[model samples]
Every structure is written in C-alpha cells, then in structure tokens.
Target: MSNFARVRPIGRRRDGRPIYPIKGGSPTLTEQRDEVMRLLQDENYDGDVAELLQRAERIAGEIELAQQREARLRHLRGLTPPGDPDPNPGQRQQPGNQPDNGIPDPVSAAEAFVRSEALRAFRERGLRGESGAVEFRAAPAGTVTTTTQPQQNTRVPGIIPQNPDFPLLVASLLDRQTSDGTTLEYMRDTSGPQSTWNKAAVVAEGADKPKSGPFTFDLISTSLKTVAHWVPITRQAADDNGQLMGYINGRLTYGLEYKMDREILTGNGTTEMQGILTTPGIGTYQPGSGSTDPKLITVRKAKTQGELALYPPTAVVMNPMDWQDIELDEDANGQFRVIANVTDPGAPTRLWGLVVVTTVAMTAGTALLGGFRTGATLWERQGITILMTDSHADYFTANTLVVLAERRANVAVHTPAAFVKITFAALP
Candidate 1:
C-alpha cells in the first residue's frame, strides 16, 4: 500500500492515459511554470530564434526578388504583367499549367481551342449538294430536247487584248488591188490578210492620190546691215491721236528728204562730198490745213579732211549752236577735235540741227583732221523715232501706221534673208 496506494489517481484519463499526480492531479502550476522558464533559458533558445527570423527574412526577400524578376522579363518581351482578369491571356500561363489563380495566354490558348471543324459543318448545310459530295453533275442529255434560255456575254466591250505578236483586225471589207500598183483603200482593211470580212466596198479606184507638198516654204535673201535708232516719245503724245498722227507724218516726210540727200552725196566722190544742209520748212503745205509745225531737225554731214601726221587721229565732234557757223579753229593746248561740228539749232530757227561731220583729228605738232571713213553711210540707218506733240491725240490711227512702217524697215534691214526648199519622194 505505501506511497503509490496513497496517491490515488489525481485525474482520470478519458482514453486510459493517466493525468499527472502533482498539484491537484495536473502537473503542478509551479512545475509548469518552471518548465516554461527552463525552456526560455535553454542554451539553444537564442540560436533557434535567430534561425527562424533569418528564414522568414530570406523567404520575404526571395518573394520580392522573384516578383521583380518577373516584371523585368515581361518588360523585355514588350509585355506588361496582366491584371487580375487578363485581357491578353497569351501573355500569361498556358492552359494545362495554369495555377489556381493564374491567367491564360490569350493567343496560344485561343488557337488551341478554336472550333474550325464545327464552323465548316455549319457552312455545308446551306450548299446545294450533299454534305460530303465532291463532284457536280451536268443536266441529263436532252431528254425532251428542252432548250435552256441563252445567257449574255458578261465580258466588257472594246477591251482588245494587247498581244505583241500580231496586229488585231478591227473591221474587214471585200476589195482587190487596182491596176496602178495600188490597193484601193477601204474601211477595216487588215494589214496582212483579210478574214471574217464585215465591210462592203462601194467603189474600186485605181491608185492612191499623190501626197501633197510641204505646207511651208523658205525665202533666201542677204541680210541688210543697218543701224538701230531709239527715239523717245512723250507719254502725252503716246496717248494722243492727233499729236501722234502729226508727228508721224512729219517724220516720214523728213525721212524721205534725208534719203534723197544721202543719195545725192553718194553720187559725189568721197573727197568732193562736203556737208549738206537740211532745213525744217521743206515740207509740203496746203492752205487751210492744220499740220504739225517742225520744232527740231537733225542733220548729218560727211566731210573728208587730210591724212595723219605721226599717229592716226581719233574722231570727235565739237559742239555747235547751229549749222550756219562752222568753227575751224582748234584749242591752244592741242586737244584735237575729230568731228567738225555738232549743232542743235535753237527751236524753230535752227530746229535741233545736229551736224555729224566725219573727220579724224591728230594730236602731233601740226594737228590735222583725217577723212578716212569706213562702213556704210549713216543715212542707211533703220531706226524708230517717237515724237510727242503738245496737243493730245489717240495712238491707234496714224501712230500705228508709223510704228508698223518703222518695225518693217527694221526687220528688213536686220534679218538675214534665206530661202528653204523641201523635197518629197513617193515610196514605190
């Protein structure tokens, strides 16, 4: 009986495992507290706690690094990680391998589960033939010879094939060669041979008509060498008809007179030809008819002085008031004057007279005027001179005539005259 008998079961075991006997049938409170304290004070306690904390920290770091690496890889592939319900399933996990909370790859998964065969079965029901038949049978050969309606040609008209080897015949006609070694021209005539003739020839002629000559011809002539003159017309006279008409009439009459004088000078020898005088009042006048009064007139004089002293003299003209007084004296310092005189007579009296005397002046001790002249005379000049009167008149009437005459003369003088001939030969 002893101490074991005295220690009755402190706690009954439900499944036959006996409870502790210290301190009211449970392990004693002091002993439990002591065990907990002993565990806290154990030698490996700090090491175990440190190992657990390190393991937790490592797990957290690994999760964070894995998420970062996934994000980086997605970025490199030009993709973004999908949201919860992904729009692009192809960017996510595959079908069978998808996790419980994983998304699917949109492109690859859709291709894998496509229903193409089902769609084909649906289309077959609408066709005329049986579901799986391959050949189409023609209508039975003329049981009653029932004629089917004719069908129209669906091809577009006039679209000729551009075959490179042969020319396409558009139309054809019936005709033969004539006696003059020429085939009578007909519509739709094929180049090589005639077949499927659709046109009829109305008449059969001999040979083809001879081709006509060239449409243009050329004229051959020498170029008339002449000088051009530019004359300024006032704006007022250009706008006025009466003033332009009067100026043109006066200029023409004056031009003709100058031509006569030039011809006379040409008749005379070079040395014998002295300076010729041109007066302004030498125009035809009618009673009671109003005409433009001449205000200025230019006179060109041809003169021959002697030969050169030492060096040839350059030509120059001395200024003059009018043609009346010709100054023969030279300057004291020996500045030689080549041209004898250039005079612009005052208004009506001298009438803007310019005496262009051809003379060459030398600069040596005995200064002399040379008379060697080259080229055509100045009178053969082709030029236009526009004059303005104080009175206003329209430009089209008489002014147009004057302008045309001047232009014609200029063209005749400057243009080289040449003739062109064209030769055409018929092929045999």
Candidate 2:
C-alpha cells in the first residue's frame, strides 16, 4: 500500500454506520498499547492529566446528586395520608406528624373541639377562666375537709367552662365613669381607710364553698380617678357592697364674654371710668396672638382745652379759650358710648379723643358655661390653643376618643364585717 493508505483509518464502523474518532486520531492496537504504557511510565507527561481526572470526578458527583434527588422525589410520592401508621416501625417521624389517613384521632379531635369551644366562649362573653360563680357559704360547725379532682371529659357540646363576663362588665362600668369627677371621689372612698367593701369575697347561690379567694374590685376604684374630669358628675353615692347607688346628671358648660367702654370729649372736657373687664379665673395674662397680651387700659380721664388734659393734648396751641369735658355714659341703644361734654362753648372747638377701653370676661361657675363656650369656640378654630409662637403651637384636645360600656349583674356582696365564698363545677 501507498504511504497514505498505510496510515490507520480515523473511524470505526458499527453494523455499517461509521463512528468518527474523538480527536481525528486513529492508532493500531499495538500503537495504542504502546502509547498507554508510555503515559504510565512518563513522569513529565502530567500537564492536564490531573485536571481531566478532577473534571471526571466532578461529573460523577453531579450524577450521584441527581440520583439522590430522584430517589427523594420517589420516596415523597410513596407517602400515604396523614393519621395512617408508618409501614416500617423502625422509621422515625416528627412530632405532630401523623399518617396521611383522612380520619383524625377521636381523642385528639375531641380535645381540639373542646379547646376551641372554650376559647370561643371566652371571647364571646368577654369571660376569663378566673371569673364567674362568686362563692358564699356558712362555715361548717365541725372540721370539713374538701378535695378537688380534674373532671373527665363529658363530650358535651357547648358545656366547656368559660370565663364569666363579670370582669369585662366591671371594666365597662368603670370606663363609663372615667370622665366623672364624682367617680373619682367615690373611688377615693373605696381606697380610704374607712372603705366598707375592701377585699371581700362574693358568693353565688347553689355552689360549693370555695377556697378563700381575695376580692379584686375593692382597690379598682383607684384606677377610675385618673380620667375623672371627663365623667363630670355632680353627686355620687355607693352602697356597702361596692355598688353605685345614685348620681346627679348634668352636662358640662363653658364660655367667654367681652365688654367695651368708650368716652367722647367736646372742646374742653374730661372723662374717667374703670378699665376693661377680665376673665374671672385668669390669674395671669398669656401673651400670644389669641390671648390678651396688651390689656385694654380703662379710660380714666378725657380732657379738652386744658393745661393738664386727661389725654395727651393733640392741639398745637391756637384757640379762642373754649373747652368741653368728655364723659362715658350708657346710650339709648344700651351700648356704652363716649358722651359729649355736658357744657359746650359758644363756638365748636376741636373735638379731643379720649382713651378707649376693652375687656375680656371668662367665668367658670357651676354651669361651666364660660369654659364650655371657650372650649367650643377654640375647638372650632381647629383645637384649643394653650400657647403659640411664630412657628410653634400647643393644644389641649387629642385626636380621638374611644368609649366602652357594659352591665354587671349579681356581683359579689361585700360589707365592712365579712366576706362570702362559692364554687362551681368546671365545664367540660
């Protein structure tokens, strides 16, 4: 064969179709064997051989990982329904883990229902486990020991024990009186040394004698004192049992009024009067835009054509020696006015102006009319302004108010002398 033909073919045939060599290289069996032996023997031929081995290992690792993921997916698909027992006893399961069975355990289901129902009852009536069934019983003549045991499940619907609404009711009652001043006074009575119903037990009829439980509502009156202003009650009375007996009902009122005094002077006249009216309880003037910083000075005197005039002389000293004195008087329209001088000169002289008077009146009495009016007016101006600077301000009212109320029935009976105790069976 020629040299070209002597070279080995670079492809192989499998049942007639040709399969090309990977790198266009073809070697005889003897040559391939010699090349493999040379690679094993040559220490200098180690350039990319380690890298190729590492790449092969990486591919093997990927294949193993893929196989593991496939195995996990198959295992997951084989899982049964919850509540179903595991097929293999040796296999461990997580807590709360149950078989895939559709049916839940009877015991667990019953317990869940009971718990859910109990919670529902507690929320519906605003009850707490510690509430309800205040106890009262005459002490036994002899030694009487009592024992308690956890009640077994009775599987009765709507029979689970719940917190009575009494506590919530009491809270609501106290909230209703939060704004009443008399409520605070009553609260103080409950807290004072002479309190009649402090730390007394309440007992309900048809119940076992309960273990001694201290009273809760006695000291609660103190909390009501904080918001007493809003409650605004005139009179309040409570019985020895810590119950509200009666109260005076009325609305609070407040307002502000103003009066102005003025006087007029003729050619030669003088007038004298008291200054502007002021707020009744206003101890000090608040210097601000809306407040009376520059108090209105009263028109003490108004004089005309005189060396010492009541007011500063406005004339430049040129006249025929005529004068009138101005005076403050009530006009026919009932409005205060500057009256003309009683005596007038033959010829009309230059009219002299007298001092002007302004007044602010704020009266807070039993009616609260002044304060309420002021509050309303200020509220209409957006909010009550206690004080304000060029760019800063302060207010008394807040953004919102929330009110809640409730009625409590058959509360515990308490007096200065003794207390009562009662108990009842726990709900299932």
Q: What is the lDDT of residue 341 in candidate 2?
A: 43
lDDT of 1 by residue, 1-428 (tens): 45554554433333544445666456544444444344446555433556445544655566678789988877554453445344353343222321110111222211221212432342354244322211111121122111433222232232223222211111000010111111111121112111112233454488454433222222313222221222334534433433433333344323432333332222222222212111111111111224221111111111111111111212222222222222332346755323333463221111113212211111111111111121011221222222212222453233221121121110111100110011111112
Q: Estimate each model's TM-score.
A: 0.15, 0.11
lDDT of 2 at 230: 20
Cα lDDT for residue 275, model 2?
12
Predicted structure with the largest TM-score when compared to the true one: 1
Residue 152 lDDT (model 2) = 24
Distance from true location, Cα of 203 in model 2, Å? 79
Q: For model 2, what is the error of residue 198's alpha carbon versus the real structure, in angstroms, after optimal superposition?
A: 59
The candidate maximizing lDDT is 1
